[model samples]
Target: MRVYSKTLKEFLDAWPGKKRFGIYRFLPLFFLLGASLEFSMINWHVGEVNFYRTYKRRQARKIAEEILASREST
Candidate 1:
């Protein structure tokens, strides 16, 4: 069982019994909160072209041009 995993079991054993149970009680809520955050932040593009990719490419080109101009001037 997960309770017997080396690290988790060792940690639970090292802590006092009440504190260990308190952590277990909040674990499910933490998992739910993490899942909700991941879902909300996901990038959704079912059909349209990826605009982020194009924007990053444009930014990179501009940076490269500036670097080349600086090297030529120096």
Candidate 2:
């Protein structure tokens, strides 16, 4: 844990003011950062997860199926 302790010390040293953030503010930011990193890595799934696509391609497929079902009843 030497690396972690050293990094922690560095972070504490870098704070600008004499007043510090309370644990409440600090913990939430830490958890948010961790969760964001988790989702960001999942985005690397690319093709399987469609990471960069604005529109989900599955919407068109579902609409096509519904249209075909309606035509069959005629």
Candidate 3:
């Protein structure tokens, strides 16, 4: 049996458009993807709920609980 492994350079070299665009070719694709995701997260909502708002509330609750727990223990 034979095992083959490719380094980062070898892997990148195998990607399409590397000859003309180099590593910079992926930047716009990723940037647009991230922008679209952010736009959706901000604009698209499920009924009255928002993902970031819920996440922030949950994080705040956890921190408050931790603070109260520490105060009670002292």
In terms of lDDT, which candidate is strongest?
3
Clashing pairs in 3: none
Runs in model 3 deviating more than 4 A are 1-17
Please write out the lDDT profile of model 3 over residues 1-74, one tens digit for every residue.
Answer: 23265576576567688778876878987999999999888788899878888889999999999999999999
What local distance difference test score does each model get? 0.72, 0.67, 0.83
Q: Model 2, range 18-72, lDDT digits (tens) per residue?
A: 2565434467668999999877865767566644343455677788999999999
Report model 1's TM-score to 2 decimal places: 0.36
For residues 1-74, write the lDDT of model 1, one tens digit per residue: 36858888887567655454865865776899998876644554446535565678899999999999999999
| Candidate scoring better on TM-score of 2 and 3 | 3
User: By descending TM-score, how would the candidates be arranged?
Assistant: 3, 1, 2
Clashing residue pairs in candidate 1 are: none
Minimal lDDT window, size 10, model 2: 16-25
List TM-score per model, in order: 0.36, 0.34, 0.67
